[model samples]
Target chain A: MPKVTIDNITIDVEEGTTILNAARKIGGRIVPPAMCYYSKLKGSGGKCRTCLVKVAQSSAKDPRPMPKLVASCSTPVQDGMVVQNLTSPEVAEARKGIVEFLLLNHPLDCPVCDQAGECDLQDLSFGYGMEETATEDDRREFPVIDIGDKIKLHMNRCILCYRCVYVADQLTDKRLHGILYRGDVSEISTFIGNAVTNDFSGNMIDVCPVGALTDKTARFKSRVWFLKPMDAHRACGKCPGKVAIWMFGNEIYRVTGRKDQFGEVEEFICNECRFEKKEPGDWVIEGPRHIKRQSVISANHYEEMKKQSIIDPIAGEMNKQE
Target chain B: MKSLTNRSKVVSNKQMTFWERIYFPAILNGMRITFGHLFRRKATVQYPEATREFSDIYRGKHVLKRDDEGRERCTSCGLCAVACPAEAITMVSAERKPGEEHLYREEKYAAVYEINMLRCIFCGDCEEACPKEAIFLTKELVKSEYQREKFIYGKDELVESPDPAKRVDVSKRQTKEVLEFKKDKRYKHNK
Candidate 1:
């Protein structure tokens, strides 16, 4: 166990817990936004450096504070460590610079972008980026890539967070896609010019922090704010079918992995639920409206593997489906 | 009260003769002034047959611009509607369907865009506010209509020609100040 004091608030955590997780345990108003850190995926942290926080003191064994601000997502919580986050002026300034760099090559075509409302990059940049860009240099541009009929990759929106790559390799059963080249010309591409289509390619779009990757079926369909997400799922032969059905009017527009109250997808949904199961009758309605965070967990217990353990509504619904 | 000097108040100098009182000379002077105007350029033009040349900055009926590829440039972000002082602009946006790229410049396109010409002041605020360079105030004046509903211009009437050559050309309407602002290269991807 490790006892750490972050911003005068002390907390205890398990040995391997990083400062970002320790901040999450501290809870209210502390967790620094992690652009590259997906908690479910291992080794997805340390790349973004957006969660930098100062360590004012350390354990007696070290006896000295760290030389520079450390990335909170990767730094292990040392016993008796003193961390300064939100209240620290230096950390906030550095974070503003981090956000500025993330937005340096990002296109300002938010009007046409599908991820305008629910985008993490949009929210973070609005919260931390400079109002006016200091650089007058030309921004990097890339042609939009359509990877099969399922996903569209707008490389201009990418900040190279590696969350999608991490999900594609670690969370799913494929590694056909990865970043190619290096430096400013780096791009996410399929291996040997192959099309990046695997069963779980749909989830990559959900894990993306920007509009870099998007659901082709749902692209240019409806703005996220206008669409109402409902709890819906169906019988599946392969993976768990539990998912959120986004609808506009009477039409079921699209389906994706359902997120819990924390906005993280609770379980990775497979392609059958995302693409093939499109009709209204293919699904059994799970719970009340999924528009609010409080209802997300209650509405999301339909994952097939865990279907029996949670509740037994399938007996009646199975007859209904048949 | 009387004038200080009698000469200052001396009535019509020397009583007018009867011939002068008839005022033929005064009538002739009025005719001369009227005839002078006839020789100068005509003030009223014969409209419909011969149109008057409007000034360069004349803001008239609105036209939604299309890109050179003949795709509608408006993503329907509603900036033009928000910028309109008279609240004459209204629009609805929809996602671009697959294979519709040639019809729309972006993933989102204006499903319905309308402007109430009766309420619009033609101030060109919507023109300046548009980020995609989609909407412009053209030199074409709004025609007089018999019904209030007829004054509203829908996307069908507002959109420019799909043919690039026949498209509603508003380049000549932009001022020097606007041209300088449009030269900003900070947002390359957007341009």
Candidate 2:
């Protein structure tokens, strides 16, 4: 185990653990915001530089600070290494610049985007971005395209985080899509009309940081804030059946993998569980899914009374389903 | 228990004086004051023929605005619906199909928008929440109807007319500072 100090808090972790993961272990505000890094996926970091942190001390032996702010997602921890995330004003200023670059070509279509309320990019820009964009240049535009019949791809809003590419490469059997171009005109596209279809293709929509990819079945139906998220599961052979089902009244609006506090989906669900299971009877309900109080999705949602109930009626129902 | 403060008062059943028992002078005094009001200016005007002046910022009826190009400005983002304390606003948004760009300003448009006028407190939070400068509470009052169902205003009743001359003016409700802010070209929302 190696000892690391992040934002004045000390923690001991395994030698190969990255700075972002070490901060995540401590939890709360100390954790750097990551747009591209997915803990479950390999080689998913260092693309989006939102998680840059200042290294005050390299290690116990060499007490020299790194020359520049390093990407915390890819930088491994050293024994007695001292890191500063929120405590360093240099990192904060650099992060704002990163946010500006990430949003440089991103369209201002959040009002129409399906992933507005729960979007990680939306939260990141809101916290770090300037009120007015300094650039007057026109943003790159692309007509929306359908990836298979289940997902819609809006290339205009992609930050090129490459998380979706990792999902397609790692989870699915045959990867059909990846970053197509280079430099300023790069885009994520399937080789024209060749739909990216597989058992795990739907997981790409969940991993996308922005509204670049969205569930086509739930498109324009309703906003995320208007729906109630319920923890749900069903007996499936392909993958873990656990998922979160967004409902409007009694009708299931959409189904997605249950994301944790850091917005990472721990278990990648199959397309059958993500797209096809859209009925209340398709799975057993397990009460309301917990949402952070600050999130817009939790505006009118409350679960205090549900927590105090004595009877375990839903538990019996879950057993019956199993 | 001791009283919390010194403001408490007691009631008494005391005998009345001769002047109070008579009640004749008291009645005459009341009549004199009542007659004095007959020669003074009236407090109210007749509602049907004569109307009183309303404040410039009076918030009565809501109007869904149209852009200068005559396209509907509401994207149906649900901010107004969530900001509504009374929860009177509800809407269903649909993606703008090809060739329908002239009908809506954004990619999403309110396919169906309704407001329960009876339940609305007219607090103008929806007006404050509209980011597109779409919804505004105008000086025009909501007309009374015979049935409750008629009070639920649909998009037909809420959206302003497309004709330039017939458009409802709500400039009076917006402050000068807000108008100045909206004029800045740096913000994408202004553009």
Candidate 3:
């Protein structure tokens, strides 16, 4: 175990432990806005670059040069390591640059996106991005690519974060994704015209840091702000882990991996648990007046009649039988 | 077989009054419109010689990214492939050789990468799928070809030249420092 000082606080961690885990052990003082890091998983992979930290050695006499600012999620802890996270010019600049890059292709369609209320990218950009972009032309125009029946991919909003692919391939053992081409020509795709048919396909919508990937059923249906989020948990209908579901007005809008149960590996519920939707019969609706009331007063009268029927044995039995 | 008709209706070919006979007014009107256009600023741009100002976010031709050390940043992680709406990109992964560390930044590198320009819809999905900043869409849209085979672009053509302005100097001192700090005897064994 190595004792490292992160943001001036000292903590002990095992070898190969990333700075992010070490920070978490010590209450996460040096917080980075990481969207792709799943503690249940083996590697942070450092795809988002949001959790950057500057590190230095504790001993001034050490011949080693100061550690260059690297992603905290990727860099492992070292003995006598000193990390500086707050007010560091390098980290701030990196954060600004990363935010700008993430927002570079975002469609500014927050007003309609389902994740707008809880989107990590939106919150981070509001906290870090410049008021106006210097870019003058709208570049990268391509017709939206439809991967399959379940997922509606809006490529324009993607920031290239590989969380969906990583989860799908490494954690879930679904090798559904691969990189094609090199440089800016590279894109994630399936073989030929095969659509994404994984049971956990809906999780990609939740895991996507941007609006690039979305649920086809939920698209253009409801805005995030308009719906209320209720915390609900259900036993994994297919897998061992329990699933955390977010409900909006009795409708289950999204399902995700529940924290505190498992680490990043298999951190989320399996594909089946994540994509399950409540059918029409799943909801219970009450009310219609016996007299066929068209207005609120008549509706109230109908409710009274029902209450009266419940009190009367014959009427109650008739109503119940019907 | 062809049939020729000798029957014909009477046709008049008479010259008209001043405006019709001379066609001066209509000619003048046509000339006025032509002259107006000629005197107006020509919107025609001589392409290949003249270039239009594109937006910073304008996605055009793809450019392969290099790190500060001028090393390729792609780790051959197939995320971009999964995110691509169009299956236009294809790549094979190759492990980096010991001495070739300067060429590639990651242990796993993209060995063969090809893009079917003919099939690509220029959606910038590939640019969005890259995690290492290895790929970008440059503002070079004029990719025309006479033959279909010429449309595919390989790694040799995709890697972008290092931007002189964005270059960072990683001195030997910094490199040595990084090496010493990363000198846990464990990493070598794991590798």
Per-residue lDDT of B1-191 in model 3, one digit per residue for the tens?
33367466567988687767788888899989988897787797787699778776666777677876778877665545545567677776665668998988765577887888877777887766564557767667836889988888998788766666753222221235445744543332112
List each candidate's DockQ score: 0.26, 0.75, 0.01
**Deviating ranges (above 4 Å) for candidate 2:** A304-322, B12-29, B185-191
- Per residue, candidate 2 scores C-alpha lDDT tens digits across A1-322 of 8999999999999989999999999888889999999998899999889999999999999999999999999999999999999999999899899999998999878888899999998999898888667788989989899989999999999999999999988999999999998989999999877998899999998888899999999998999999999999999999989999999999999999999878998788999999998989999999898887688999889775444233676764343231
Which 10 successive residues of model 3 chain B have the least lDDT summed? Answer: B166-175
What TM-score would every model get versus the actual structure? Answer: 0.69, 0.93, 0.50
Q: Model 1: how far is A86 from its true place, Å?
A: 1.1
All candidates' lDDT scores? 0.79, 0.91, 0.62
On residues A1-322, what C-alpha lDDT tens digit does candidate 3 reach at each position?
7888877788888988888778777663356567667664455457778887877663334636365678878888778887777757788878888888767667665533555545678768876777666565554545566777767676666676777776567555466665666666556676776777766555666567667787665554433433333334444555654444444456666555443311232345555555554432332223221322221112113234457665796977554432
Rank candidates by DockQ, best first.
Answer: 2, 1, 3
Cα displacement (angstroms), candidate 3, residue B4, comes to 99
Candidate 3 whole-model C-alpha lDDT, 0 to 1: 0.62
The full ranking of all candidates by TM-score, starting with the best, is 2, 1, 3
Local distance difference test, candidate 2 = 0.91
Per-residue C-alpha lDDT of model 1 across residues B61-97, encoded as one tens digit per residue? 8888887778889998766766678889877788777
Model 2 residue pairs with clashes: none
